[model samples]
Target: MRLGQRLRTIADMVPIGVTMADIGTDHAYLPIYLVEQKIITSAIAGDIHQGPYLSAKNAVAAVQLTQHISVRLGNGLEVVKPGEAEVVVIAGMGGANIIDILNSRPEVTSKVKRLILQPMIAAALVRTWLHTQGWQIVDEQLVQEEGKLYQIIAAEPGGSPVVEPVLYEIGPLLWQSKHPLLKLHINELIGHLRGVILAMEGSADAVKLAKYREYTIRLKALEEKIRCL
Candidate 1:
């Protein structure tokens, strides 16, 4: 019950009895919590680094859940075999890193039923890759922790895309639902877009200009939407 707000938000997306692989699991709190709550019968607590893996091992041992959870030392999904995990939870890392992990093991995506991701940055890039890779975005949610907003997406291996490039930029599902945190998330995005636009404007380089212009078009639309807020 005392779980951190961020972990709790991530935990809400896990369905009962689904085997999970917690990539970049620092102390393996998510898998431990899920196993204790009976939401997951088995889980793999994976960390690319040995320090974190040892920490996860100690934590699982503390909970007497070493049997239910397997803490493995390896990078990304390297410790997980194909068809091993039904649900893959990748958290506590940037979206780019998460994308790299998935990209490295294309077969892992094909084998899993669900992917729950919480990206520190570049979520749009992750969403973009998911779109091209035939992954379907079924659910999207946001949470604010210590003045920072985090986006968590629940996606599968295949489906029609409900979001466009701009939506990916603004998290279409979050905008449509009008979640209470949308205003904050939108404003931050707008600021980022504006900064990018301004920096691009100062540069006379044509290539950067064109790239910035493209981003500006989306930013302007976002600016207008945030206006009503």
Candidate 2:
């Protein structure tokens, strides 16, 4: 039941003593581990793909947790019923897919008490969606697993009005708390933006030029903010 750093980070974000549904659950490792540790009472492991669904089913049976964990073969929140789980975890997928899942089943999602999301790409998009859709990014974690950085967001059903652009680009909690990895992540983003700006310098495309200037301006602001930090 050993969870990798990425999955472990997501697992750590789950509140204790609440039933959960793990969407896109490949092998049901997180649910199995949580149940074994007594961190959760029961879980639903849902996977869209047949191979992974069967794999998860076998994994759950191997551990003799058939009664505690329900392994279902369905896409996104379709497998999750309203009030079935207080928390829903969607991990190991792109941010767009996570957003789609949430949007596809707002009826079920609205009733969910918490959402733990780990977006492999386009994390900012996920944050933006959360903000605009009435969910709050309550907590966030940045983890570099096997040399690749991953962002995990934990959200609840409510939030106050927020500034979209800033919260979307930089996590609300991460920016305010100044997490230990914030500086590192900012530096990496700055470097990447700088490279993009440079590549766009020789281009005559108006769109590219506009984006280049925008990124350059943002780069300077982020640099200055980092200096203050």
Candidate 3:
């Protein structure tokens, strides 16, 4: 099972030595890769749906990693207890869904040393919610996979946080680190912004125009922020 470079990079970013859990483990690839590489001693491949759970179970079995990898069918961290895992990886989901999983259980949140999040979309919402909850993004990575750019953020609880308004749009680490691909992604977003503003033209409703006008302003401000970047 060859994981793509982007997903493989996310797997690489996992703490070199620790027990971790992969939530919504569709094919259980991350865990299998980590354990096979001996980076992690054990992992819990958990998912909310039966299809993914069974797929993960079958994969784990085929790899003969059943002992090192446990496949459980459960939602979020409801199946994980505190102090069991030091690292958690949640990927291929929306930011809001990840936030919901984090907010759903305090016990799981309190025990982890790191959270590796690779949201498919709504990353800004996830980053904002994490900042509001006092989590610090320690590091991040940017990669273009299958024509779409994705950001992978690793965060931990505690310490002073700095979340600028524009941080949500471009990500604090991406802005601070100035990851090269970030510029390209921002450029793409600016193009989208232009198209959105163009689409809003000829709308007669005052409320609709007002709402879009506000969004346009926000987009322009975001454009300026990127320009500065």
Model 1: lDDT of residue 228 = 65
Task: Give the alpha carbon lDDT tens digit for every residue of 101-208 in model 3.
Answer: 999988888889999999987788888887888888888899888898888988988764666666786788888888989889778767876777777775656437
Q: Which lDDT value does model 3 have at 205?
A: 63
Superposed by TM-score, candidate 2 places the C-alpha of residue 151 at a distance from the truth, in angstroms, of: 1.4
TM-score of 1: 0.94
Q: What is the TM-score of each candidate against the true structure?
A: 0.94, 0.91, 0.91
Q: What lDDT tens digits, residue by residue, belong to model 1 across residues 70-180?
A: 999998999999988999999878889999999898777789999999988898898888888888888898888887789999998776655656778777678778888
For model 2, what is the alpha-carbon lDDT of residue 213?
69
Most accurate candidate by TM-score? 1
Full-model lDDT for every candidate: 0.87, 0.87, 0.86
* lDDT (C-alpha) at residue 99 in model 1: 92
Give a tens-digit lDDT track for model 2, residues 140-174: 99888888777789999886476636446667788
Name model 2 segments beyond 4 Å from true: 206-210
Can you list the residue pairs that collide in candidate 1?
none
